[model samples]
Target: MRSSMTIVHAPQSDIKMIPSPILTQVESFQHWKNDIIRDIARYRAWLRDNVIYDQRVDKELQLIQARLRDKTLSIAFVGEFSRGKSELINALLFPQSEQRLLPSTLGRTTMCPTELIYEQCSEPYLKLLPIETRQEALPLKHLKQQEDRWLHIPLDINDSKELQNTLSHIGDTKKITVEEAELLGFDCQFLESSSDAHVYVPTWRHALINIDHPLLRQGIRILDTPGLNALGCEPDLTFNLLPDCQAIVFLLNVDSGVTATDMQIWRDHIGQLQDRSATNLFAILNKIDLLWDDFADDEEIKQSVKKMKTLTAQQLNLEESAIFTLSAKQGLHARIKGDEDLLKKSNIAQFETLMFESLIDKKEQSLRKNAIEKTIFLLGNTKATLQAQLKQLEADNRSVIAMLNQGHGEMKSIAQQAKRDQVVYQNQIIALKASKQAIAKQVNTLLLSVNQDHFSTYLETTRTNFKESWSSIGIRESIAHFFTCLESDFTHLEIETNTTIKIVWSIYDKVLANSKLTHNANDDNHPDNTDSNIDKNIDRNIDRNIDRNIGNTIDSNIDNDINNNWDSHSSEQEHDLDLVQPTEFRIFEFNHSLAGLKTKATQYQKSFRSLLSGQRKSTHHFFNSVAAEAQQIHQAAHVEAKAWADGLLIPLIQHATSRKLLLDQKVKVFKALAETNKSQRQKQQELVQFQASIQLQFEDINLMIQSVSQKRPQQSFYESLKLKSTPISSEPQVY
Candidate 1:
């Protein structure tokens, strides 16, 4: 039976606050982040006085802003037992702490996974869950709420080793006689049926360490996962925790290379990156110091490492650039001692530089990109509105200047031209109106094809097919088959969307052709009465993919790990005498499998729906865009035609009237019209100035972004770690 645990809100009294390395330097990443925050603020201001947006646009902008406010980077490090996973973490983030943050030994010490975190301004502490809770199979998120279920251990940050000592228990496990293990819920059915057999069980199922390290203090939380066994037992680790991590590093031993066990981990965990970004996943060839050849010089060492990197890349079916090699032990030692030569030998500094360049820098780029895209889009709309406002001002201003100078004789000709222009505009409006009606009819027809019922029917068809194959094919085959179903449904949505886009453009072209501006009936000198109109504006579908491949790039980085989770504790435990008890293991396995099956259908439904939702949003957004494109052209034409007629005729009429009127009446009316035009010109000038200033800011932001993006590895760090030898084959050299 499990016992109740006590919980206390971690107090912030007397905590050692480490200043972040990032804050100490004004790096490119920090600079970009600050710029983005300022841009977002300016964006909000612009939106306030200018553009009107809907709920969806508002929600998206808010989310990007929230990411700015809460700048946390979470990374997960996963590997099998004895891969020096702990040492690599210690090397990367904990070298300055001067004490080992977690336990690492030649033996399998890290029994369960641990998440190292530091809530800003909170005192350092530890939360441990006892092994007894494994029976309940409750997720850690729920168990965390009970507070009492955890063993809270507060730390004395003043003592350097205090944290190290407390965290040593992460590696702690207890061995029990087979019979005793069976009594405590381990399965011992096939363990030689021996009374003397012993089984090892982790004393704690999970540990949460709250420590104030420099990186952690700066909003970076690292998840140090356990060996393959814990990944088997912990469902929450595979599902809830790992999926949320911004980046995941898979560590492998250089001596063993991609072993059978490593391959399994790759196929299950790392392979899931097909749905997520391949960029977010990294494979490290660790313990490279073990491969140092006695006779090998600098060149030879380079060749060997390069070959190994290439081979590793081939085995994993990843890009060679994605595979990096380093010796964690040497790296930690070098970092602690500040030995540059040893650091080169360890290849740690190069890896660190690349991480700073690739991961951390890319993270900043991603945030800025989100801000820039939305800002750019909204600003584009604001600029168009300002231009529209200005066009009206320009038309009115020109009319006043012309009216003041027009001769009485010219009035008759100008009036006759205005009348003819009005007729021409009327004809164009009729054509435009007819075109708009056709578009509305087509849009309605297209929208009918995308109703909720239609989508639901497609999903139901997929689910029905999934249900039929699920029992016969088992998990792997069933999953592959389900993706096929999704592909089919996705294709249906894509095809329908593509057809709609074609129909919309076809209607646009046909209607816009009907708008034949008659220059002969009106003023032939009108600026818009030329081939430029048709060539420029009528090509409505230029470069715009209506559904944009129906989010082809969107589906490339999917989150498909929801249901395809494979437990890592192999059935190799079935006969191993030195591991988990067999009889109880069988029961645990059955229970976990049964539980997984119950949730499988639900998880699959959620996953497919999420993918479908992305494509659906793309379709709708595309629909709106096409509609807006067509509308803008019609609106621009209407406004221009009116402005031309009003601009040309109003001034001539005013001049004719001024001649007839007495000086007093003419002066008052002339003054009022002149003041209105002057006021509008001032505002229009301000809008132009504002646009220029914002454009400069936008240019600076883009230049800075590109500088970081094009940031090539300088010869110093990159050359030190460059791989000289290439693998034998271009193809995946299966090991």
Candidate 2:
């Protein structure tokens, strides 16, 4: 793939340098997002100039802009303690430093799950959440918003030693009694005993590291997790946080192979993440340098490493291509000393290239669908408006030409024909009003299906069931029953929305058909057989002319894309010819979030103790978080349904009403021409001039729609795997 960085060799290095593949792709992705934002802004300006912008469209576009600006590409590193997760993070992000940025000591350096991120407003610091907060009933997300609950430590970015010393505070521990550990939400059976009565536990529950690093400033976030014991105790880490990340890198120790504890961590935490299709999973056999020996040749060592990869993949039930053997220590050493040969042998570069290929494409596709799809719908609205106006102008010019050939008595007959056309427009407007009421009644039923009261009742029933039985079987049954009823509600909402759309579109089709009949009658009465027809022959094929010129306007001036970007599976986009793309109302895609919770619920059921107090704490921890998330999802779905109903029904009625007013204005102009002594030449010239202006405006609208709807081109994967001696400078701030 093409990168934004260039190679620069050191003084003593034998070969030229290569940049980091992941960083290169990240730079390219940031540029691609900026292009999408710019296109949306231009589309909004076009709407305002065309007199079609409204309050609803303005609010929706603002939300989309906010989502693109705040976007972050997050990755999580998960494994048990002593698996080299911390070491791998240090090697990947801080290769140029003289020492490891994060302390990777002999054992359990990262005692809690720590996140590394960059915020422009904040100075360099470490924020720690105390372990005592585990006794509360609030979820982690709510706790994070309260600044007073965390302890903060400041750091100097220029001093590497000071930063390293401050980061080692994450591994600090406290000695507490076994009874005290249980009271603080830790299972006493899993703690390491310092004495007969006391055991060791982590002093903090979570850590947040904010610093000005090159990759972190580009919106690259990293999460370093603790061991199996911590994962079993925290439902927020497994359910709310880990499942939301875009990619996960799970590491294993090569010398120990896949032990029983390693299998427990995989089955309980990392493996369940595969249910979320958006998350990418990969396994690393770290600390491979321990297998190297001087007695064996290079070919023999290669065979041994290949054998380990095959066995590890089979044991984890993953493909061999997803597993790699690498020594984090060797990779860090090679990058610091500018040794290209040692870095190639370490195999870290190969792993990074594959990660870049898998992540960048998926992130780009997701941003396009979320941010650009709505812009395309708005563009379709503008296209339909312009095309309708062009058709009306053509019909009006035909009437003026026929009036020039008539006597005084024939002019009187022509005025009566205009009166008949007004009646046809009036009947169609009445039909649209009746359809509006029918759609409003159906929309209310769809909203009621997803109301908060229904979801609240379901939550209450699940809580009661757990309180009565307090058993593991009760927990499993309650969670399964809760999601089943919620799924039924969504199914009902989908069925109701489709039925409403079909009925409304049928009414709109009848109105269009009636309007066409009125235009054809006007054409038959006003046949332009005089020499004036020859003057208008140059502009006869107005529609085809606009299409040809629009291709050039979009390619040279706008986003250089012309094909339709709306979903092909949408029934409205398929059947409607007027480019009304919003007829197909989409509910939220909540399936991935629901499936991730179900997997975590199953794990929670298995890990609970038999005691009544322990069961109470576990139930409180799991259900409180689930209830809060469900409320937000249900409320959002209701609001979106309301917006879609208004968007689909209101604009259609307004369009029909405005067309009737246009017909009235044309009748008045014809009556004035029949009575007054105005010159026939002056009237004909005015009609012809108005028709030309309508044609130009129609072409401009078509070009603007194409500029916003085109999909962006993707870059090819990079074949070479290598890194520079030093990291490149950070990218410009996107927001």
Candidate 3:
């Protein structure tokens, strides 16, 4: 086996063993990780400043950024108990240690899931979580929040024996009763089914071996699990932690080959998903020294290893080239003693070369693919959202311009109607003012009358006085009825607007319909004359339909927009309360600093005078509101009617000649807004160019998808992730 492995080795003239690819890749990955972090940070800042926010989207970006910053590539070492799993990790990381850094021997079975990590400028330590936490059904991660539950033992860095003694405790276990096991959330029925008097349980759920190792310092995180039963009991490891791992080193004893348990572990855990390639899903045939049959020749050992490799590959459904057979014990011994020939004989050189050559390269590509996708997705979404809003704003601008252009002949028609409207509205307003004046005079007359003013004063005197003063109190009742009548003004105005709109339409239809007919008596021939009549007829019909359909459209708009989606009656009730309740019929009581009834009565008269003055002022406000509201309703109706009517108006009579300056001013306002939007337009252009560049980036990192199917196009990048884009279809996309 040694000779066969050594024959495949590269010439070692320049091979230095200490700074391996494990460290090399870590450095490469750090750069890649930093670049991704910078990309995400830039994106995060842009999103914050732009106020682009979504709960899911922002959170996803935040998580990716955090993962990039963490930069720890977790390599899970999986195998059955005592399969030299820890030994391989020690050989890979701490090759020069004279003593065993991790618990690895022929008979030792690790009791807990251990995490071997490195911390800069810190002494070595072993942190253990209690076995009692199993009952909480909580992961070690959650229990980590409470520091009191953990036992943290500091290790003396210079004392290797002391460190080994403390680390050896990771394989220690305690015997507990069936009742105690039940308390730990273990099913008592299953334990009782077994014949054991007391169940042996791990003293710790997880262990953290913090050491100052070179590879560990380079952000290498090693997960050393007690492979078989530990994996079965731990749900978090099976689902969350293990799935995110960059690599899983499945170790097997070379003498035993692929055991039934090893195949089960691969099938159920390691080989469950092909998401990570076989290169990352590694299977190590360790303890190859056990395969050394000193009695047999080199050919026999080579044939045995070849058969084992082929069978392991078939069972794990992995490429044979991805698997490696090595003597971890021999390699560790060589590293400790500086024995180069012994290290080469261990068959670890090829594994080291593979690690140094491809581990980081593959990891970098995988990391880049994930990072680029996330960045592109988030940035694409932001660009899409901004683009969508911008497009709508632009569309609105165009619509307004088109509508304004539709009103080219409107103001002339309004100017023509102004004279007629002035005469009619002036008469109606005059009558309204006169009616209001009479009500004021009546109220003024009532204020000065002492008999009416003293009604509230006597009302508190006796029940008999109240009955007698009820007639005077009828003044308050009349005031209440007046407000009710005032609310009818809104209804009256709506009716007035309806009538005015009808009259305008009637006038427009009559004139435009009749104008061309009155042109000539014998104008049946001459192509121009015939064309003129046809044009006039088309104009009349178009304007009439525009008027007819627009009313329905406005009615539809009001129905859709006016409802605030709360209590349908809340708005009406609020409006009714404002117009009525406070001012409505209440007996006037004079509050003063006098004691006598006569003094109060005199004060009551003064109060009544102020009340009358306030009511007159209120009446002025009331009339003004009603008058202004009526004018607005009519103006709105005219706008709706004119929008249609003006479209077909004879330019000679209905052109907006009087309002050219006003129209020009409106143009300038719109032009200013359009000018301000230029920056957003520039951003939009840049975003599109950015999209193309990112699209090319998508093409570069799209290997994972290509691994499945080659026919996929770059356009399907977002489609695969189920993202959408509102593309400006007018612009063609280049491949």
Candidate 4:
């Protein structure tokens, strides 16, 4: 039994007040306002028809609930060549493990993103997949075979030895051979020559290898990227890949400091990703051991540090305090030895602390809080809206019940008509169900017909085109001609050297004029009081001493009076010499210096000349190597293309065709059902009319009840019902 009553009360002064809950949470409502409006419209429609509306509501709620679940936080390590990204990961993970899988040398080591995860299961498995099967998994041993697309390596133990064994198979240090390139499905036409020799390719083209490690399984994904510069001007490796990193560590060699190339890399790659307020960037001064040795004095060491700090700051646009200096090798040693003192001294301890406590932890907390706050706000608004709608629906239902009570006399007559309308609606629902099933079947069939093999064929064709295009350009010959021209320009060093010396002599004459001086004596000829013969001897000695001291200083002590005059005169001469000597002597000194320079320059020219000749001989050999590699790649691409066409594309095509046929079948079924349900349309029309009529009656009944309630003052409905000896029968029942 249910009761429906309508009452009109006097408007309260606070009726205009907005709910505090809604006002307080205005920011939260912004994200869900559109969804909330849509939901309200849907509920109104559902009030007219319950079956369809309830189903949709349930589905929507499920999706919303799923979205509230915890999401994994992914942190990636990314940087240019040999920037120690992989070593950083190793330091974090296997503090004691000595085995290095990622290449630490000058060349590139990682070809693709390799993931390390820990598995609690007993047998450690390595999985490889074919390049064609990007989404599928395969086994490790398959990597050894030329025809095999991918490798899956499973390590049996948790130690460094086991990890090394697994890594060794993939980390082949030898230069890439023509056979290897061909085996890897590269086109041979792009190669310079058709020889069977080895060629070098950049290491970023292969698939990622996953190693089962305990630390990685704990939810850390380390990404090692190729050098900042790409090979052969390839766009994919350079401009396309590096922008997505969340945190960056820029490694600089302490010995070289930051070179022009490093700045170029920064401008081209790192600077582009910077947002000073938001991004966390670390400049690591690596290999700091080069700055000092055990025998280096304290002052020298301090000066070196100061110079390194100043230079790094200027080049990187960072404060001296921001840059961290560390030795990666020494850090690893400290971690293994469990020596905290050594680790602190090694400089990596500060970096480790920043990563673990400051950066990673802060990021995680901020992301989690943001997600939670957003979810709570959305959920709260949704709940409030639902409550308001429920209240309104209750009021509407009460009015309907009252109407039904008032129209009891007409209801029996309408029941027969309503039954017929119900049958019509049921028929329409059945027809719609049939149509939906047909559409689903068609979609499934269509999906099956879409073959993946066609994509592989397309890839192979593109690769072949690229190879032919490279070959047609004849880049090797162009490079050779450029080298030849450069060699010829530097061949006339001896002639240039002679011309430079002649210019030096002309400048020296002007310098010699100011250096000549005349000294005064007591007597015009003889100053000392002595015989002419004795005086002549003394004068000779003095003249000899003066000659020795000219344009130079004499170390021997003389009479104080004589020394004072000489010093004063020499002081005056020193000022004049200082003005002219540097400018004049430098020219002559440079001429002398140029002799050695010219010899070295001539030797360099000869060496380069020999190298040019050797390069000409090697040009053919290099081209042959390139050509062979390209040909091998072309052959492999051909085979792979065929396999892809057969294995993936053909099936997709068939599946698509089948799906289309199924869709056609579904369309036919829906058409037939619609025709069969034509009679049900009339019944549905009658049901709508009867519902409207009943609604009007309920409205009238509610008005009458309200009038009666207003007239009976000083007693509420519930109180009135309680006072009555017999029940007033205010509650109503309806189905």
Candidate 5:
């Protein structure tokens, strides 16, 4: 029938360079983030040394630093079983190893979704949650925090074979009754034996692989998912994990092509990602070595592979350029033997380079927006403060020189003017503090609009309604009404929050205008007299002004696309799609979290097999999970709202305090010159030295700001690969 392929083995060599382009980019991004953190630390120290430290700003920097340290780049591999998903991960992560790093073999190797990550606090181990925990009324996220609930197995990193053997337990299964399977959310149709009374189910619901791999240590997380059945059974996979992943690698077998099950998986899970700009999608036609025919020449094999890739791209509705063909098994073997020619033939390197290049581009842009842009904006404010101080100093210096020329008469007038400005500054400080209190009260009122107690009441009312009528329609309608109320609550909260933000902004702006008027009135030499026209009508109707300026107000926009409803029953593909747009809002995050819960509820409602009397346990479990998730969301939203309210006046207060300090210094300087016996020449020399000192400080801060904003140049590995476009023949080619 077919000629055997020969294996040419060479001495295995260690991977000298970073194994993957994604790893390279992650390393660069991590280093750049560290550098920025170091710069921020230095800037904070400098501020403290200069006696200009703002506690509020320092807290914000601390929060940013924490986020940078905790940030992770996650990639998910999705496909049916036997698609070489696990094999591809092994080839990518442990190329030099003689055996597979993960359990990648024939049949369903990964029965549960496995996440490979690194946590420095924990030793190398495998943490697995029992499948029975599915009956728990808490979300997986909540369950993860309960360490005792997971079965921990320590991993021996020194032995790759031992590690692989241990991970193979992810596919461990147990025979359970069909009733139990259905109760645990398993589709019995996928069971090994439909005629049997019992079915095989995954022993573990989820897997966490924590290791000290270089890539994982640098915050690169790999999510190895199960087949289509698992995707449908686990709501977290569809609603939470899939949506959160930045890149999804959808694998398909070249020989099998795209089957109905594959299309279903794509439409329900991976297809929607095509609309997400933040997420990079790649359809991989794996196991290409299966198509390597002994009867065919090299050109014919290439043509076959190219045709498969093109068809896969069309099937997935992705560009051909985004579809890659490779043989993970061959790639792993090639790497282990250090056979360069075999590795090239495997096409793994080419696929990795292109896929990671696209992923890295998106990742870098996100980092730039969240870290670089926000840091620059904050530093810009500090720079503005320094410049303002310099200007005030120069103005004070000029007044001193004026006193030296004009004599005692002008000095007395200047002293009187400084005292009047001091009184005005004190009044403005009290007014700003009052405004801060007012906003705090308003934010407290706004938080009450989303209170946990209120949500619990609504949930209880729905449960009561459902219990009154024991039909499926009653429960479904009750759930729908609950969600409708929930959505209405957030809609009302959004409106109230916007109003509060505008009111808070108006009060701060008015106080700032008053403070500026005082400073400008005193500093005759000050440049930019823009504050003179800053709506001197603060006593006018504030509500009318807020309404007029609502459009200009910073609306807390959200990522509406992150939580699109997954309609599994609807076969029609949704052509109208929205990308994940950039926006900042804690409420939106909370809102999206609710969207996932709503999706879970919808799935649960559809899964109802009987009336409430017949399926009381299932119905109760569903409602309990929803209620728990709702309570958690409420608590989290409360915390965010409280923090927001606390920080609302921080920037304004910091600015006002800095300006007040400068004003006080000016008043003291004027008094000292007016009442002192110091000679004119000495005063002039002191002024000159002060001006030089301010200039030096300004230059140092400017350099620090630049260092924080400087971009790190990362070389693109995809370009280095020089991959050619797929060659299509004039005539049709088929395998």
Candidate 6:
């Protein structure tokens, strides 16, 4: 059995033993374990500081922890208007129910955030609380006002009945009325009193709901977002709440793969938060059932799907495979029929699998294993290399100790020579200091003779020159040029407005003519003996009214017309007009000031010159005093330089010399260690090769032993005797 095992032998020349396989394996295991422990500690600290200790992040962490404990995962359904987001949710969760949370009509829905959670209880209660300034709750009625507040309402019903009733009030497709706005507590005056009166008030119902559903009970929460208009209208709800979702399933109609409105929503809201690693975003090309008509073949549908996927990927900066095509309507039908095979045939099943794998399963596995593997690989190699180097360093240190002792005496002699050189430089520094002091004293005396007040007087003369320059240029003409430019712009605007009014009035006349003929004639017959003059007068009045209305319409559009004209005219006029020319005036002022200052400067120079001529003897006396002070300064500097040379420079030079000696010794030691390391590494390599050979030989012998053991029953007595005799003759191999 032992002979069957592979054995590796060391080379005859290689006395060093490389570690055994068991030891190598243990070392690898230890390295891996140590690195794991370190990484865990590091991650623990980071998690504590960033995720746990920080108040804002702590809440998120706590929520994550709670969700994990509850085995719940949240999927946010988000996109622009009419993207089939709510339809997708219904298809996934409650296909059988006739009621829906979405507003299918041509009006905005989902006014505020709504959360769907699981409740085991049968009787659902509706709880309403108004939004408040702080955490304190307010009355639900308060939300009716035009305040920056929200409301929370819990409805009462076991099924979807209560939800249907509550949402019905806000789900009407008709134009919003003043009465509805008053009931919703919205300020209607802004919409009702405008000259172009238009009512588009948002729905009143806004709350989080807890429903008893199989999906919710299975630990899945869904957020069916409102249309683009509603979300854009209330940006705060979208930005603050949508980003926190674990995953977003963006639904897009397959018929209209991507639209301008979708791009607008993406740019304004989703784009900013798309880069986060924690947020898992997916795109759904929904309503594929619409494409399954007779006109389009399977291949055409496939190509269309591919094109949409590519376009979406390019727009969103994501992988093409991430965007999926599915039919929510088909999925709903498949689910209700209990046809697993049919469900698998649909794209919705593929999307479901993708969501489960990418968002839930794969994400959890990546978070666990990725860092662990990276840390193990990195630290394992590092520890092995460091251990090898450390071993060589220990042997080299012994040689370095001996070399340092040998170089000690020579280092001291070299240091002494450096100190002697430092002394010579110190004497030179003293002479330079004396020369510098003498020059400084002469410069100070030269400065003291000049008067600064004369310079200010000269600057005043420059101001007078600037005033004369302005008079020569004629300021009135410059002002007239500016007014001329202004009048031209105003005239251009008026002309453009008049042209636009003429065109608009022509269109208005045609519209009025058509409208007058279309008016019902039945009211005329019902009138009891109406005066003919009165009817004629009314017709004239109507004509006059139409003219006035058309006039007002032209007036309303005048600003836009003028602005467009200004944009075109300004571009052309910008090159022609350089009216102000302020730069020219500034330059004239600067040059004049400098010219005036020159006269005062010259007078001051003359006064200094005359003083020097009369007081030469006194100047000589001052020079002598200055020279004496310079001599004293020179002496003090000489002493300071000498002290620096002796105390600082000499020691520094000595230290540098000693460092060089130490370095030379270290180099010699390193050379010896290199030779030793080279020899050891060679020995280890040879041992490893020999061990591999032995292992191969051992494996061969094991095969022979197994064959012999198996053939023992079939062998004759003579054959057995021969086999036993063969081992006796090869007794030296046992060694």
* Leading candidate by TM-score: 5
Task: Report the number of the highest-lDDT candidate.
Answer: 5
Clashes of 2: 2
Model 5 residue 709 lDDT? 76
Tell me the lDDT of model 2 at 603.
68
Clashes of each: 15, 2, 1, 48, 0, 8
User: lDDT of candidate 2?
Assistant: 0.65
lDDT of 6 at 96: 25
Q: Considering TM-score, which of the candidate structures 2 and 4 is the better prediction for this target?
A: 2
Which pairs clash inside model 6? 4-702, 7-694, 7-695, 8-691, 126-154, 126-155, 127-154, 144-185
lDDT of 6: 0.40
| Runs with alpha carbons beyond 4 Å of true place in candidate 3 | 1-17, 36-65, 95-99, 119-123, 178-199, 227-232, 267-279, 293-295, 352-366, 374-735
Give the CA lDDT, 0 to 100, for residue 90 in model 3.
69
What Cα-based lDDT does every candidate model obtain? 0.49, 0.65, 0.48, 0.37, 0.67, 0.40
Q: In the order shown, what is each candidate's alpha-carbon RMSD?
A: 18.5, 11.1, 29.3, 43.1, 10.4, 42.2
lDDT tens readout by residue for model 5, 359-390: 66677676666566656656665566557667
RMSD of 1: 18.5
Candidate 2's residue-wise lDDT over 1-735, tens digit each? 010111211335454343556676677677766766776687677557655566667677777777667558788888888888887887777443334567676667787889999989999899999987876788888988998999999977666566656787888778889767776667767677884679888888899999877778888888999886554467677666787678888889877778887887787667777766577777888877786677767677666667777898788877676777787777766666667777776777767666655566556566666666766666566556556756765775676576574632244345545555554455455545544654566778888888888998998898788778656666667878988888788888888777656555544554455446544544564455332442243133222223332332223322212111112224343222354434456574654455556667666556546223435665677667666666666677777778777777445543444444555555566566667666777666656765675566667756755665554443342322211122211111100
- Whichever of 2 and 5 has more TM-score, that candidate is 5
Q: What's the ranking of the predictions by TM-score, best on top?
A: 5, 2, 1, 3, 4, 6
Give a tens-digit lDDT track for model 6, residues 214-233.
Answer: 55665566776655444422
Model 5 vs. true fold: TM? 0.78
Please say which candidate is ahead in TM-score: 1 or 4: 1
Q: Write the per-residue lDDT of candidate 1 for residues 569-655, one digit (tens) a residue.
A: 232322111121101001222223223322432243233222233232222222222222222322333333222222222221222
Task: Order the numbered candidates by lDDT, best leading.
Answer: 5, 2, 1, 3, 6, 4
TM-score of each: 0.57, 0.77, 0.47, 0.38, 0.78, 0.37
